[model samples]
Target: MTDLPVRIRPEIAALPPYRQGKQAGDEAFKLSSNENPFDPLPGVLAAVQAAGSFNRYPDASAARLRDRLAERHGVSPDGVHVAAGSVSILYQLTQAAAGPGDEVVFAWRSFEAYPGLAVVAGATAVPVPLTADGRHDLVAMADAVTDRTRVVIVCTPNNPTGPTVTQAEFDAFVAAVPGDVLIVLDEAYAEFVTDPDAVRGDAVRAAGHDNVVILRTFSKAYGLAGLRVGYAIGHPSILDAARTTGIPLSVIAAAEAAALASLDAEDALRERIDAIVERRDRLAAGLRAAGWDVPDAQGNFVWLSTGAETLDVAAAFAEAGLIVRPFAGDGVRISVGEEESVDRVIAIAASVVESLPQTHAGRR
Candidate 1:
């Protein structure tokens, strides 16, 4: 091996950086990233404009946002730790809880950010494979735990796959795991879930599990992806440690303001969310009706398990101006995007599904 720069950690040197979703052209709808389709609510936009006091640093502690969240979740202000994004909080929590020789467990093919976070934390990632139906294999995940295991992250409506862990399943998993192991429920897409059986982080944390932390973001449901504000609800001590590992003052004033404004405009936003949810359902149904064995899509997206056809399937989507996130050798995740984009995606997907040979993996 060649001599590396300033003795960078060999593993860090080998690790790949996070790859963002491909950007769409002006004529194409970008559904690669699981982002909200609606523009920021008018109120949120107003808040951002009013927060244009760029001359001063933001409140580093983010007390107002923290307190607001604390009240909503019925936790103390210190229990809420805000960051640039929920992914950032995930990284911070990883850093705070684990280091070299430690292991972090999560579902395979989950949020693409999971293994990357563990790598940066100098921890080993033990990714349990998802069930064939695209749900977390909770029993297998629990079995993967060893003494070196320090943290477990559960993402639901598991990204790229769209199946959510049920509250009962989550409870059973929690009961099965060791008490000392920290579990972070990544709920970035929680608001998009309509299933009554879905596991909700806030409810789990409220049940007095000191080892559990619930993560959420304003990026998805709140339509603040560009602004990057997210938070965690957990035991104060755990959150305090995560906060310390985070970049100080990283959550900007505009983001804080927009988050606050989002809360104030929750009713309006809920209506918008409702529309998206309806659209997501319609799209999922359309795909299934097209003979694609789509999974239970509880989020604002659907998972097309094309297996070996993943790349070819994605190319077909791109050819039709539907840019999707394709996990080669695995599947394609098509985010439920703009209303117009919905018809475009489903139409292209239907053609792709129909054109597939009878022997294709997803064919009934």
Candidate 2:
């Protein structure tokens, strides 16, 4: 690493940039990103074409899309805030809520971006470890809060690990947190969730907790990952603070158009989501049957608690033409990809689990 002549903030200098999942060659199934396998809706491209004004800047507020989302979520348009992606909104919320000497609390081994976001905001990152089953231990998280704590992020259908914070669990957790702390419910994979017990962000918004903000993205279930459009729903005042910290005009016209089109084609989108949910359930079940201690996967991916064998198992999957997200010694997260990939994952997983030592954590 080269040092610049200019002085850099030590925390900023120390922070590693966010890493995207590896891209696969044409032959391999790219399941590392937990991406939606389906293509964009039929109306999506046409909408992008309709909004083809390359010379013009996008509406900074993204009014139409905000209005549509507000209608869908039953919130006022001012309650909605759009950005480049939900992760971008997370950054904005972090900057808006926390700063030097403040603490940002979230589950460890969750989103790879959480810690970096806090650091970028000049805040201390308080990472509470997840439960053995790969679920957020909200009780422990609440216990981590202190006077310096400013923001708390709860990723439902938690990324990488694939377990959701149940509705009751979320309710209790919210009650435990102080009113001054902002609770950002990150539901990037909310559309893929089928569990009746899972927390619903929209319901939370309707209940009107001023400190809570719900984040959703067009990237996942809507299959608009390339466009990079996502929005937040919460109290207008809270959103105003986030807007103060956001990069202007980051949400472009094409992304906004595509999101609006996706909303119009909800029926078609629902079918794709339902398919992904079904695939995810089957994948989780197959891995478990293969003697892996798979977690409750409510999202569009499954977690393999590969423990000490993490990298080796991930490498084996890669050799078998499956690219999965590996968290070093923790586990491997395999997204529910093409229908054909499911059986391949199961076969490779069965062999890998058998190869592990008898006391390996991944073994059932």
Q: State TM-scores per candidate.
A: 0.97, 0.98
Q: Can you write out model 2's per-residue Cα lDDT over 66-182, one digit (the tens) per residue?
A: 999889889899999999999999999999999999999999899999999889999999999999889999999999999999999999898888889999999898899999899
Stretches of model 1 off by over 4 angstroms after superposition: 1-5
Which one is best on TM-score?
Answer: 2
Against the reference, the lDDT scores of all candidates come to 0.90, 0.92
Candidate 1 on 159-274: residue-level lDDT in tens?
Answer: 98999999999999999999889999999899988899999888898788889999999998889999999999999899889988999999999999999999998788899889
Evaluated at residue 334, the lDDT of candidate 1 is 88
Predict model 2's lDDT versus the native. Answer: 0.92
